[model samples]
Target: MSKADEKYLDIVENILNNGYYDNNRTGIETYKLPHQIMQFDLSKEFPILTTKFVAFKTAVKELLWIYKDQSNDVRKLQAQNVKIWDEWMLEDGTIGKAYGYQVAKFKQIDNLINTLKTDPQSRRMIISLWNIADLKDMSLTPCCYETLWDVENDRLNCMLVQRSGDIPLGVPFNMCQYAVLVHLIAKVTGFKPGLFTHVINNAHIYKNQIEGMKLQLKRRKQAYEAPTLWINPEIKNFYDFTPNDIKLIDYKHHEKIKMEVAV
Candidate 1:
């Protein structure tokens, strides 16, 4: 089994068995646990779940829409046939000042790339989407926010701090995509992919998703080996990447687990 599956499954099992049942702002109750973490060495394996299928291409499209395009417009994602954010899109055709909007506001991606290129030893390399002043304007606040970057011995590492994570649906997508982000940024900045650390402050499973989560847990013992991530070697610029340029080689999983979004 992949190391990701081992770690991820452990977390899921922990939440299901010992989590606190409580009501939340979403009007749906949840089985939640606090301060859960997962770390991975990207050089060893790609951090994607093999117990159940994850929509890798769709995740990449959303990541690109945010970091590459720096857009808050849901229309751009819809243009690519990605509809994950359709529920949160406001009447104005945007997700407000939530994600890509904050990136554009401070040119965060540009600054991070520039710093990675010029000052590899700097300790201040960071990109954050949690804009305090714009919180009220956002349709939904950023969950997987704040990324801290590091460089060591020609390798790049990233740490993602997520304020809230829906374990069944959101966490898997977030894990794979952020690892891909590290690979993309490392390639553009001329470094090897190193480590990825994910920290979730409140990791929860919505009541509606419990059955789906249980079905996934049943396949835990049959998890397959980790797949290799393929990025186009010829692409030197981050913005040049598309869904075709990235792929998962030999990704094996049981099947898709259907779960409803709490929103």
Candidate 2:
């Protein structure tokens, strides 16, 4: 079984057996756990779940829309046929002062990249999207809101902080995309991909997703090996990457496990 699947399933099992049931703002009750973490070494293998198929290309598109394009327009994602954010898209044709808006508003990606290139050892390399002053303007507040970056021995590392995570539906997508982000940034900055760490303050599974989550749990014993991530060798610039340029080789997984979004 892939290490990613092992760690993810462990969390799922933990929540199912030990989590506290609680009501939240989304109007759905959840089985909640706190302070859950997952870490991966990119050099060993790309961390993507093997127990169920993750929409890797779709995740990449969403990541680019937020970090690379630095856009708040849902239209741009719709242009690529990605609709994950359709639920939160506002009538103004954007997601308000959330996500890409925050990135563009502060030019956070540019600043981080420049810092990695010019001041590799700087302790201030961070990108944050949780803008307190603009939360009221956002259609949805950012969940995976901050990223702290570091460089050592020509290797790039990242730590992602998420305020809340929808374990069954959202965490899988978030995990793979951020790992991809680490690789993309490492390539652009002329460093080897090192480690990617994810921390979720509140990780929960909605009541409606319980059955599907249990179905996935049953497939744990059959999980396949980790897949290799292939990035186009010629693309040194992060902005030059297209979905075609990033792919998984031999990504064998059980099947798609559908679950409704709580939002």
Candidate 3:
């Protein structure tokens, strides 16, 4: 079984069995568990679930749209055939002062790369998209907002702190994309990819998505091994990377378990 699935399924099982039932802004209530964490060694294996299909390319594209392109325009993603953000897109064709907007506004990515090269030991290396002042203008608050970076023994490590996670639909993508982000940053900064830790302050399964989660759990015993992440070594600069530059080789997994997003 894929190690990612092993850990992920455990969380799903626990949530269904013991999560706190509650109502939130979405109106559709959820079974939520607080402070759920998943840790993986990026040097050992790529952490993507093989128990069900995950849209690796689409996930990476949204990632690039944020940190690399520094864009909050939903039309930009739509141009690339990614409609994941369509639900929250505002009238001006952008998410408005969210995600990439905050990253660019604070010059977070540029400063992060520069700092990583000059001082690998700096403890202040953080990329945060949770701008309190900009929240009111945002179409939707950033869920997986902050990322803190560290370096140890020539390995680059990261901790992703998500304020809230919709386990069935969003969490899987969040885990994989951030892990790839760590690799991309490490490759550009001249270091090996080390630990990738995911922290979800409120991890929840929507009431309507419970059946999908239950079906995914049934495939746990048949999950495949983690896939090998292939990156184009020729591209040294992070800005040169495209969706095609990175890929998953030999990724075997079960059929897609369709789930709905609670808007």
Candidate 4:
């Protein structure tokens, strides 16, 4: 089994058994555990869950929309038949000053890329989306808000810091999205993909989604091995990447476990 399955399922199982029940902003009660962590060696195997179906293309599109396009508009995603951001889109037809807005506001992606090329050993590499002044303007505050980058022995490593994680519905997507981000950045910056670590400050499963979690957990034993992430070698520039430029080869997985996103 892939380390993603082994570790993620372990997290789910542990939360179901020991998580603290609580109420929060979404009004839906949740069983939450604090400070959940998952680490992956990207050079060994891509870390995507195979216990259930994940919309890989959709995840990649969202990632690009945030980093490459640096856009807050949901319509662009809608044009691609991606509606993941619909819930948080404000009246102005955008997600407000969040995600890409933050990335673009400070030229985070360009700075990261430039720094990676010019100074690989710089420890000051960080991208933050949790802007205090703009929080109220945002439809939804950034959950996976910050990423701290590093380079070691020609390998690019990233640590994704998420303030909150909706375990069943959102965590799976975030995990795959960031891993792909690491690979994409590594490719563009002329480095190999290394360790990709995910840190969730609050990892929770909504009360309404417990059965879905239990259902996915049952498939744990039969989880398939991780698939290989293929990137278009010709595209050395990050902005040129689209969902088509990346793919999962031999991706085998069980059926989807539908769950509600606690808005």
Candidate 5:
């Protein structure tokens, strides 16, 4: 089994058997421990969940739209039939200061890329999108609020900090999304992608998702090996990458496990 499945199953089991009964925005529920972190060494393999079909291409497009284009337009995503952010778009079709605004304001994306190229040893490499001043203007705040980057032995590592996560809905997508981001950045920055550590401050499974969680837990032991991702060799520029340029090779897995999307 891949480390991702093991970690996910462990969380589900803990929630089902030992999680405390509690009430939150998702109503009365048993929640797994929050602030529970899982780390996967990307050097071994990519961290996508083989037990379920993650929208890997869609996730890549959205990530690229945010950091590469530095855009906040929902129509840009809608043009590609990706409506993940449609719910959060304002009437004017922008998402306020949440995503690309933060990228542009601090020049965070370019700075990180430049630092990775010139000073890979720098410990201060970070990109933050959760601007407090811009929160009130946003329909929804950023969940994966921050990323801290590190480098070792010419391999790039990333630590993603999410302030909140709806395990059945959002966590899986975010995990794969950022992991791919690490790989993309590594390639553009002239290093191999390494570890991806996800830290969730509020990693809770909703009450409606209990059965799905239980179902996923049953297939945990049957999960396949992590898949290897391939990016086009000739694409040197980060902005030049499109969905067609990113590919997942030898992605073996059992049947996909479907779950409810928490609102």
Candidate 6:
């Protein structure tokens, strides 16, 4: 099993079995443990779940939708059969100028990639999508808000900062998607994938999601090993690539545990 899967499953089991039950702002009372972190060394393996089909293509599409397209439209996601954001889409068919907008507004992607290839030691290599100025305009704030990229020993590393998380509904998808980003960026910028770190400030299982968490935890230990990721060899540009360009070479996983998504 990949260390990523091991670490993630460990956290899932630890929280469900021994985390503190608490209430928070969303009225989505939770079972939360403070400051839980999971890190994967990508030099050894890709950090994707083999225990469950992680929708690697779909996750890549969604990531591109936010960062490349810079679109706030749910219709674009719907066209791709990804409805994960349906609940949070506004009546106007937009989720506000979130995610990709921030990326474009600050010319984030190119700037970061350039910095990574140039002065990688610079601590300012962060791309943030959580715009406090536009929060009220959004149905829901971006979950994977801040990402810091770095280089160590000629390999690319990334750290994703999530301010709030609904573990069952959001965390897993975010983990796989961002890890893919780290891999893709590494490929585009001429470096090997290194480490992927996930930090959740308010990592919680909602009251309604307790049973589901338990169910997932029951199968967590039984999760299969991590799978290999394959991106099209011809695809060099991140923005030009689509769902068709990325794939999971051989994913293996247990039965998926159903869970409610609390908006």
Cand. 5 Cα-lDDT: 0.83
| Per-model root-mean-square deviation over C-alphas | 0.8, 0.8, 0.6, 0.6, 1.7, 1.7
lDDT: worst 10-residue window of model 6: 48-57
Q: Point out the worst 10-residue segment of candidate 1 by lDDT.
A: 62-71
Residues 12-100, candidate 1: write the lDDT tens digits: 99999999999999999999999999999999999999999899999999998889888999999999899999999999999999898
Which residue pairs show backbone clashes in model 5? none
Q: Give the lowest summed-lDDT range of ten residues in model 4.
A: 84-93
Q: Write the per-residue lDDT of candidate 5 for residues 1-263, one digit (tens) a residue.
A: 77887886676677677666678654546475678688988889787787777778888888888888888889999999999987778989988877877898888988999998888889999999888888998777888889999999988889999998777678887888888899889988889989899998877887778887777777777789888888899999888989899889988766656765554
lDDT score, residue 102, model 1?
A: 93
RMSD of 6: 1.7
Off by over 4 Å in 4: none
List the global CA lDDT of all models: 0.94, 0.94, 0.95, 0.95, 0.83, 0.80
Highest-scoring model, lDDT: 3
- RMSD in angstroms between candidate 4 and the native structure over all alpha carbons: 0.6
**Over 4 Å off in model 2, which ranges?**
none
Tens-digit per-residue lDDT, 90-143, candidate 3: 899999999999988999988999999999899999999998899999999999
Tens-digit lDDT string for candidate 2 (1-263): 89899999999999999999999999999999999999999989899998999999999999988999988999999999999989998999999989998998998988988999999999999999999999999999999999999998989999999999999989999999999999999999899999899999999999999999999999999999999999999997877888899999999998999889988
lDDT string for model 4 (1-263, tens) is 98999999999998999999989988999999999999999999998999999999999999999999999999999999999989887888999999999999999999999999999999999999999999998998999999999999999999999999999989999999999999999999999999999999999999999999999999988999999999999998889998999999999999998888888
Give the poorly placed runs of model 6, Cα more than 4 Å off. Answer: none
Candidate 3: Cα lDDT at 43: 98
The TM-score of candidate 5 is 0.93
